[model samples]
Target: MTVTVQPSPRPRAARSSGIGRLLIAVYAVLALGAAGRSAVQIIERFDTAPLAFTLSAIAALVYFVATVALIAPGKAWSRVAWAAIGFEAVGVLIVGALSVAMPQLFPEATVWSFFGMGYLFIPLVLPWLGLWWLATVRRSERVAAAAEAA
Candidate 1:
């Protein structure tokens, strides 16, 4: 008698595909830009616009987290991506509105100011794109798992 061993299912494709790589690159650039700006603002003129500088730092952190989540493997990273992207979306909307309504509150521009108009609205659009990509990845993962199980 001969025994046969089934080959293990192929792993799922990485989340960092063409568009995903573009997204990661954008997030990385934004993270660096925000962090540098915040550092300069805090170091040189924190007293002038503490709120704006602090918000800039927060935006930097969000970008960095989202970038890492996008590149990292596993469901946990996907969850983190969702959370970070969601927070970024809300932050942009709130900051944009507040900046328009109460410009006095922010003496200097933050990363989310004016809905990231300074950055060609990339910041405003990136989170939505990330969420959409994550949804696609999840659907594909489910399909792959089902196929393997069968």
Candidate 2:
């Protein structure tokens, strides 16, 4: 006997999911921030805080990567986003800790500095939010898969 089955609807991702939009917005802000700050540091004051500026550049890079990963589709980039977001979470914690514990190490602030105090703690909070969003999406995918299988 043949089983009669309906096809599953395609997985959807819109250009304007509120959460995705917000993530994009945050990443855009960070990209500009990192781009602008890195430019200034490299141009005028690379000598004063090479380490902090480099970290800022790195933060910007991660944020940009995370932003693209969020907006784009597919399992590959989703995992990439997860990895980048996790790194962001770690970067914030590590930089926040060092900035506090070793004042001499960071004369000024990186984006991850002081738990992203300069960005009103958005940097501190955004990665965790990204991770949570990714988890939620994955769970939904699993539920959808199970339903389709049934």
Candidate 3:
């Protein structure tokens, strides 16, 4: 009797073609939204709700960083993309609850307020979308690599 062990599948390290571009666009929008809101919050009302503004600033930084990570073409970028999106998912959920349950605590709205109602729920949805986009990127990259290998 003969036994064979198949090698495990490899990790993906590149972006999809068209889908990658679309993901980049979505990330770009997220980055823009977060950055803009954070800027406003920090500049407009530093004394009113410092915590909320600080969260917004961090969220904005995360979104922009995630966008850059996903857009870059490499393995390190994939790792960064995963980290950023995961953090974003958690941030939205936590901030959403806080804003809803503790309205008084928040002097004004942040991006993740009311489950991202202000951004039309984009903040709530973008992380999931980003995961999907990254998956697509990985799959396409794998297929392309396989084709080349073949």
Which ten-residue region of model 3 has the weakest summed lDDT? 8-17
Q: Supply the global lDDT for candidate 1.
A: 0.91
Query: What shift in Å separates residue 149 of candidate 2 from its native position after superposition?
Result: 1.3
Off by over 4 Å in 1: 1-11
lDDT per residue (tens digit) for residues 48-97 in model 3: 88887888788788877887887777788889889999999998999999
State the weakest 10-residue window (summed lDDT) of model 1. 9-18
Give per-candidate clash totals: 0, 0, 0
Candidate 1 residue lDDT tens string, 1-150:
998998877666666875889899999999999999999999999999999999999999999999999999888998899999999999999998999999999989999999998888988899899888888888878888998989
lDDT of 1 at 103: 95
Across 1-150, the per-residue lDDT of candidate 2 in tens digits comes to 999997866564442265878888988889889878977886888889989999999998998898888888888888888899999999999999999899788887899888999989999999888888888788777777777677
TM-score of each: 0.91, 0.89, 0.80
Q: What overall lDDT goes with each candidate model?
A: 0.91, 0.85, 0.80
- Candidate 2: worst-modelled 10 consecutive residues by lDDT: 9-18
Highest-scoring model, lDDT: 1
Q: How many backbone collisions does model 1 have?
A: 0
lDDT for model 2: 0.85
